[model samples]
Target: MPAAVPLADNAVRHADGQGHAARFDAQSTCAVIVTHGPDPALLQQVVASVVPQVGHVVVFDNGSGGVDVAGLLAGHRRVSVMPSALNVGLGAALNRACERARELGFLHVLMMDQDSVLAEGMVHTLGAALVELQQGGDVAAVGPQFRDARSGELAPFVRFGFPFNRKLRGGPGQRVSCDFLITSGSLVPVESLVRIGPMDEALFIDNIDMDWCFRAKRAGLSLHGICDAQMAHSIGEQLLASRVKQDGVIVHKPFRLYFIMRNRVLLYRRGYTPRVWIAQDVPRLVLKFIGNALFLPARWQRLVFMCKGLRDGVAGRSGGLPG
Candidate 1:
């Protein structure tokens, strides 16, 4: 086994071939990978893609359930693994990564999910955009466009709406402003992150990005998506195409709906969610509930869990899933 360089605050270091150590501080940027029960093979691929682009890489495992993350990343000199004993949820894990990044002196953090594979030059592209945007605006963060791994279709950036949400579409190599950007593949400045505050761990899993984007907008910061900077990612376990509708539907596991419904309700209750989104999303949620109840194999279980999620959200309950 190669030697591991121990750093302050529970960080392990690996040395690049040039004997250049990771220089994490106020002047440098680091990549933080927050993962759950991810495929070790895919996670290793993701780490390899990022290690060459950023100053260093930190993997925060949110209960990966016995995957030897340290072993998977064993030989990489630029990577460190922080494994959790149980699922702590995405927001909390990312926050922990951010805390560690700050402690190690990283001024910016590029956040990504374990399965997200970056295109070549993605970090450099986003970093360049961040520098350019910050010169004239309060750029909270810049994110890459997501290309679905299975379908090869690009997901458009979102825009705020009432009754009708809009997609911000751009041609190749274009940059555009957007209302929301998923946490995965987002490059955020530490100073702006501090001002916007840590992610709402209360939501636990779902809709955390939207909540943070709304907060950033309220704080007069702009979020942008670089059209050419792409990430190969998947939104759900399965994607079902609507035979007649233009849009496709992503199918998550039954229990996953709990976090989705609960988080949206909580966001609305806290007044962080826009009235427009609430006006439109509530009806959409109802439609989703109906569709899942009718089509999903685990119909009753999903509906029951969703209803319980709604109740918990109304009751202002948050954190990891309840037993």
Candidate 2:
């Protein structure tokens, strides 16, 4: 096990004379970042992008490989580091981080990833939209449209459908309602999370955003995507080019493939998960299984892991990958 790192440097503001207002504006939100084995340069860039935007920045290092998080973020006064000796998985880290933010009087949290860098005023835009949207009804969470920094490809928010899942690419300044939003670059109300309940820690990494969104939807809450608020996020390890109308594929590492396959089965069994999603996603998962096996390097190993994931998922297994 790695040594336990301190939860906070002098940067963390302890609850004291400080008071929190009942309603939160853009700058009052705290940012929760969960990390494991993050690239130092990318991590540094991620921190730089967020520090100036939020009230507090809390980084939960999920047993990183001696990444020197403190050194990388030394000069930032409002940032804190909560390092764990074990990789506690994204769901657990997010719960702990948000709890910390709540204790520090932040009304909302901007969920972030180490690889994603927010564009200027992105958090403010999401927060602003959330505040406005909630005036009409219960707003669970709001997120921004994230684009691949490498390719100029913009990602569209998704809604479950019968023959096709709806891809939303609303015009600028439009707030599009979606079934689920990715965790990164999302601005969520800490209170709404408290109501929706903590994230499903058992599944660990993948599909956390989906589970939470499903739960929120079940509870009669809504999720919105602010089309103008943008984030430069990297999905997968690389975007390889292929002639099939350009692969445009997001290729992840082999280990993540196991989690993706496993989590798919796990979420399918959940009551709150929309049945329509399970119905629609079946083909995608099948294609994913076949595509990864055929095109990716280490095809045999990925296939073996994917099979194990299926077996374990059916057996109701959860948490980290077993040795």
Candidate 3:
């Protein structure tokens, strides 16, 4: 395992003080937003949206553009900033934040992406849903329905039921029990973290959320999607289009293709089972490789990524995102 690094010097200072000021209460939840490189304006908007409701807001900057994120958040009485000088990838950064949250006595952690904005009362809505789930005594984590910021339409939250073979889609305003995988807009209880542990930093960037969910399920925790709470996520059109177009293309950009292929196989090896892998993962990967080869600009890199992903998955290598 790579040596565990603290976020950034400034982040540590900010969090250290604020951690003492806003200790967690059982009645309140703390939110942690993870960012790599986010537009300053967008980050501010995200802070403004959640600061009022959550007990505290911690911004985990993963090797951002050296912007003064700590300065930006300094004024807010409830906000603290943590920066990672090296881009340690999202999973590791979040785990660090979760660890901090635990130390601060927070009972729940809300994971947010820097570009996302919660809908009006969305935090309260998710909080309510989580309370309901806890009362029911079965759910491990719960995520809200996500809406596309650009399109203004609800995006389906995909759920895979037991036997892990079939995927069920839950539309907007429809509640569904799931083996919770999606994380961009979700709230997780600290208890779940204590039980299943933080996301696998080994898987690093891709499918880390799903990998966590699968582990939680195996440990006898249930995951669910709460339909009422919603957030608008900026899934940039250009990146989306490229990803869809190159689903199977053997393109160049080895780093991009490498994680896509590697994480898929890693998920399977971890516990996804062969039937599930064949029915879902394989077809998606093959087509992705083909799509990249046919349409993407970096065909050779893409193919190399696919090959490496296959090799790592088969070899059962685990720990951190590929460098």
lDDT by residue (1-323, candidate 3, tens digit) is 11222223112211222122122232356788898767888888888988776677777888877677877777676677777788887788899988777666666788888888887777777766666555556456778777667555565555543334444446555667875546766778776787788888877777778778777877887777777877777553233324443321123344756666777777776544334434665776787778776666667766777788778878877555466
List lDDT for all candidates, in order. Answer: 0.82, 0.83, 0.68
> Could you say which candidate leads in lDDT?
2
lDDT by residue for model 2 (51-125), tens? 888777888988887787766777776788888889989999999998888777666789999999999989888
> Model 2: runs farther than 4 Å from truth?
1-24, 242-247
Error of 1 at 276 (Å): 1.4
Measured against the true structure, the TM-scores of the candidates, in listed sequence, are 0.91, 0.91, 0.81
Residue pairs with clashing backbones, model 2: none
Residues 1-323 of candidate 1 have per-residue lDDT tens digits of 33222234333333334332233232266789998878988998898888877777888988888787878788898677788998888899999988887776766789999899999988878877776666666788999998888777888988878777788769787888988899999999888889999998878898998999999998999999999898899887887788855547888999999998888888888665678888889998898889888888899999998998999999999988899
Instruction: Kindly report which residue stretches of model 1 are placed more than 4 angstroms away from their true locations once superposed.
Output: 1-27, 244-247
Q: List the residue pairs that clash in candidate 1.
A: 14-77, 25-105
lDDT of 3: 0.68
Predictions: Cα RMSD each:
5.6, 5.0, 7.6
